[model samples]
Target chain A: MAVYTEVTDEALAEFLTHYNIGSMVAFRGIAEGVENSNYALKTTQGDFILTLYEKRVDPADLPWFLGLMEHLAAHGLSCPLPVRARDGKNLNPLAGKIAAITTFLPGVWPRRVLVEHCEPLGAALAKLHLTGAGFAPTRANALAPDAWAELLAKSAPRADSVQPGLGGELAQMLHGIVANWPRNLPTGHIHADLFPDNVFFLDGEISGLIDFYFACTDIYAYDIAICLNAWCFEKDFSFNVTKSRALLRGYMAHRALSEAETAALPVLAQGAAMRFLLTRLYDWLNTPPGAMVTPKDPLDYYRRLRFHNAAQGPAAYGL
Target chain B: MAVYTEVTDEALAEFLTHYNIGSMVAFRGIAEGVENSNYALKTTQGDFILTLYEKRVDPADLPWFLGLMEHLAAHGLSCPLPVRARDGKNLNPLAGKIAAITTFLPGVWPRRVLVEHCEPLGAALAKLHLTGAGFAPTRANALAPDAWAELLAKSAPRADSVQPGLGGELAQMLHGIVANWPRNLPTGHIHADLFPDNVFFLDGEISGLIDFYFACTDIYAYDIAICLNAWCFEKDFSFNVTKSRALLRGYMAHRALSEAETAALPVLAQGAAMRFLLTRLYDWLNTPPGAMVTPKDPLDYYRRLRFHNAAQGPAAYGL
Candidate 1:
């Protein structure tokens, strides 16, 4: 639900002159990405998405994101490929912001996570990791384990206000996650934020992946941990072992996990939980009252963090 | 910029069971009308718009609104026609609200109104009035003259807080508008809110009309008055007489205005300006600070009211 900048008719007509896509038939602002403004565009040629990167996205990182999409798409993955303008450049300026057009992928993001969705999600993610090996560009995860302490510092003082004793509990969890963080396993570009909304499906099969703004170079198994935390949890914050088994089975079918990687799932999952909990807690405590975006309840992630912290080993994750 | 209700994948799949339109290929929540939850849907058959009527729209009027759209499109007006389901009904339940699907209308709404857009807008609006004569069901404009006092009463207390002397000025203007409200003018169905966003254009020609939730039976000339205020005003709030003249000329090429209606243009325009001003002022004063939807500036309409109030006759409107 973001359209921070309005493109005037004159500006749009002029902007389209730089692209070879046919004349604009219909265009509309769409509620696609939160950090950037997205528009669903239709033309005499085909359907596409026009994205105007807002201030939250660094212009320096945009080319990497677009290039990753192109690389994944070129290797037979179904994803949005950036449409180059007549000048052979993917990034251009529109309405005082960097803008790009991507070929529209056909599917709807599953609003509710289903057991049937997890296996395909696992396979798609593993496929992404496997295909990303040849891409030369490397971007460190901005929200990596090293960065969690800085986020915790900003929110720890007030975290207790969200839940009784949350501040001290978060401090303990952060220290544990940082000390035990996995160092040496598979590494590649991982979609760090592959939540249900970022994965699209058609006919109960994975059709495409989107929102690569959060994709970065990290341990491949850490990507699995993120998906486990995102997809294998029930609404009650309880882990579903059946879904976990299905997800891991799907991932293993594509690329077998190393013994070290398999053994490190618990700590990686906890770290993943900590990353989201800290951010959500920060947003919950920091978002001004009556703000447009109501922050997610931090307590949900807090409960998941406690579960992951208590787990004995990979067996607890049904690996 | 709204998606007030989140439709689950299961609900959408079940809901589509009632429609013969091909299997869903893509669906995305779009920022179209502010009053309803709209999703742009692409299916194997073609593109369409799914609208979930929010609480602002009365459920009883849903059929009438759809009927009006059906009537208009049946007579070749190039508007979205309601897509009936296999059960031969247009309105159905989805996500706990009445929802309907309409054939998608292609073309972009002009972000910046231009003089070239004015003539076609006027001609299309006149055609709508002429074609609307056979619609059997009649809906009175809910925001008619009688409703202003109640709205003003709710907002008047904080009115002066928005401006130095707006409260008293609003009261006086309401009195004059209501006292001299036109009695008899060629009345028919009018798209009460025919602003730039409701009209779509492609290839420099009007393509479609939309948001029929605001359509109602009212003075046909009053619709003209509303358009004169909407399409003929420059961004700085100055009246553009050249655009006004072009609009009136295009309108007259379709249907001639009665002498009484012609003479009443100034007062009608003033009253039209008052209607929008009072509503916008009410929203401005009543909406809580930092709410999701930022209220439009009431002063813009206040300035338009002043211009229309000071006009001498239809000549001032470029007759």
Candidate 2:
């Protein structure tokens, strides 16, 4: 759903001279990443993805994202390694934006979530958390509890427009969740938005993880919570316990979960749901109609929040 | 610009089973063709383009388009060849739409037209005409002069909203062009819409021509007229006689234009301009303001039409 920038062939040929990837064989704008312009580039050597960071992406965070991808790949995780130019730099200027190339990974992301996809997704998420421990760079989660109040204040007036009593329900839930938020959980780098589209698979196995733009430092279980909300829900927003059970089983198989983390699963899941719900609510109300990218329906996450709010404990997650 | 239909990984794997191409290595929806869903597909064997024909295309016309492509490629034209499945069929079904895979051509389309591009483009157009003689399919041009009057009638109501007196000017021009439209000098299969985006260049040479969905039976000179309007005008809509001269010279070097075709250049070019102007006017009036694909400005073609209308025969094009 992207390709916001147009690169002239002349400019592209000039850009490729900085890299060692050889002359361009073919290049095309790909509808993959949302926040940037992405081109599927082929050269004499191999295939690569060329990305031009749009205004939505903070240029200051680019180095961190690229560095983290390198770190994860170095730690035996499958991910795109940023290709550095002959000048020994990954980032360069092109088409009035910061651009970079990364080695292309071969796989297709699952468009339809299946029950079998949940377990491998959980294992990959756990592996990412474990591998990221050695990387020292720390970025605070931008959409944590502290940002919820302002987000609510901005979208509260129109939240009920989407569904009756939605604003009030959100307000009450926010108050309770903030008051009971967990502490002392294991903290590490987490992919806060590990949706199905960001993980690619080949032959029913996870081939690579991508889109590290949303990677940040957060509680480990909270990352798992995001996955449960993203990967274990049906199209109708109903929580599938079987998929959830397999997911947690996969995670525990990689690294054992602490008793404290297990006890906090319900609140953590609810918090994860609220995090997405607030952002989606803001985007829902603010995005202009007929924009290229449609905003996700916030009420889907509302249903998820309700499911987590009523859960008894980790057993409800089939832990 | 496209990717209207979402293909699932499981569905795509099943679709590829019919093809001899090895298992999928990588697949991504590319923002290339406007009229269909295009994916840059890579297999264990080679690169290819998977196109799912959308609603805008008529299903009955598929064979003719594929046949013309095959005909052109068999005659040594550097265009994409439709890759047949194991069943010896080029077209199949995927994602609820008719799909086909074509051998991926290696080159990038020029974003900005250069003087050197015009000559090779002209030579290629002539070669396409010569090679297409064996193609017996007789699909009429949907945007020919016969259809211009009705198109004008549809957009006449709001044409003035784009500019005062624009509607009357268009009506008058359409009448004159249709009335004075020349009889056939030489008729053959023509790539009726050979725009810069449809022609790919590599190392200052025209490596391949593509997007043959608009190919049809038409006068050869009319195709040249379309090229003149497409590649010989500056961004400001001023006619570049230098490029036009190179184009015609290069074309004549391949297939010499008859005296009648040369004499009819002004009217044919004006007719080409009118055809595009009417379509743009209709789309300009109909498309929503914030739609994903912005309609082109009708006035650009209007200016070209005026230039062609005022020309002193082929000499104005530096022939």
Candidate 3:
């Protein structure tokens, strides 16, 4: 069970009246998280996951979550489709909080991920970006392109004390980045959390995706950059060229990158590095206690940023 | 100012009643971190950091945090010495939380960490372990060779699904590791978080050390493994042999390795890799949505583990 804010299930079932998910069958706390409360349910007819929207999930994002599922399902992607309520409303009030149920897709996250996994994940991302071609666009790109400055600013005060000139250099690099960010790449819905855990696997295949909460329309290439950061890096935190090549080739196979997308990748990679580094760095400076959360080392991404910063051109990363 | 908690200056002031510190002057929230709430504070005579225990910091472990700081400070280490409270107690009760303050060292964490940092940190670790010769001793040795099973078990469930019989193999590996874990070779104290951020630099020279939260007694060689994992791995997650060499050679200079220590490098590296893999994997499976924390890819350490798994002997790592 996660850190659900004192809400009880008996109180939560009140909202199920709005939804037509058959009789409340089996609901048990999912032990896979520390934030929201999730109950993997099994009704007379099917299996679904009931998610009790926790404090971190904004109420406004409910529709987006529902709508994205509908859109992705309508577009023929394998994902957890949100179940509509009896009132034909997607979201329902439960346990004095917002809650909803989504059909669960069966799959396992890969453990011994190899260069091979990179190819499919990249290609799947290409297809996923294309699948969200006409969904309701989102405005909540929390880790978007322009947030580097704000994040660096937050970390600036302690930068000299923590790591001299780190704040200044990060700010300067970001300024240079904004002035030259990529434009006009294939845009569609993106699964920002393309980490291995979110991508479900069934018998050596990517069965379906989870965690659409972070999905949105953005530069498709950035999705590739995220995967590269996510999948292509080696254990020592250096780039695995062979792995990177496999991933890029896989992405290109599914959706051919335009000359612009191709041209923008190195900088895109750098931008991607900056994005992860800034967020990780911000987290490093401002971690909340008792959250049971450990901030990822920003230095990991900092070194990657430095690597990409030194790249002379896109060809360096085989973009 | 962290998540759902706050640390009052009055409480910190109250806690500062004992100890040699002059007076608590200024304290403010650290804007970075996803685990603990840290405040940069200025005492009447010097700078210090006040950390209010947050999630992931169990209340029962407060003594270890305070005692390690006290112990390290007593041994002439330049780190934060926990301030005792007005009740003549070190741990203070504030905001329904346990908190402590330590002297802040002046220096930047190395930006371009070089070979030079390795030996100092290694020697420093050796010195700490030596000074920790004998105190009121009995604490969980996180780096102790015996803890590998618990480490592997945490990540075992998911790993079993991903790689069949993987958990058993890891368990067996642990059995062999414990049967052969290096022991009694100049064991004293160890700083588990020997990453670049915890190491300070002035003029690119090792100026001082801080962040002793993960300090414990264990195999002295395990300290080297921790550094190898921290320093040798690049952001892209690739292993850099040069950096690994620098780190290992640096450590070896302070505490020369016994033939057993030398022979233990490869297996210890594997155990180190597994330790990080388990923690990161635990994080991967258990991270909460809406948690500002971004889980580090367990795959990064998985790759490191895989690297070590393939090595035939300890000489492979040049210990």
Every candidate's DockQ is: 0.60, 0.61, 0.01
Ranked by TM-score from best down, the candidates are 2, 1, 3
Error of 2 at B304 (Å): 3.0
Question: How well is each residue in A1-319 modelled by candidate 2, as lDDT tens digits?
Answer: 7888899999999999999999998888997777788999999999999999998778899998899999999889999899999999999999999999998998999999888888998899899999999999998888898889889999999999999999999999999998988999999999998998899999989999988888899899999999999998888888899999989988888978999999999999999999999988998898775565657789899999999999999988887
What is the Cα-based lDDT of residue B310 in candidate 3? 73
lDDT string, candidate 3, B145-258, tens digits: 566677677778777664577678767767775676666655656777777767765444565666666666677777777878877766676667777766667666666778
After TM-score superposition, what is the CA distance of residue B319 in candidate 1 from its true location, in Å?
Answer: 2.2
Global lDDT of each candidate:
0.90, 0.91, 0.68
Which rank order by lDDT, best down to worst?
A: 2, 1, 3
Docking class of 1: medium
Candidate 1's C-alpha runs over 4 A off are A155-169, A282-294, B285-292
> How well is each residue in A137-222 modelled by candidate 3, as lDDT tens digits?
67457778766687788888886655778888888888887888987776777787677657765545677877777766688888
DockQ of 1: 0.60
Candidate topping lDDT: 2
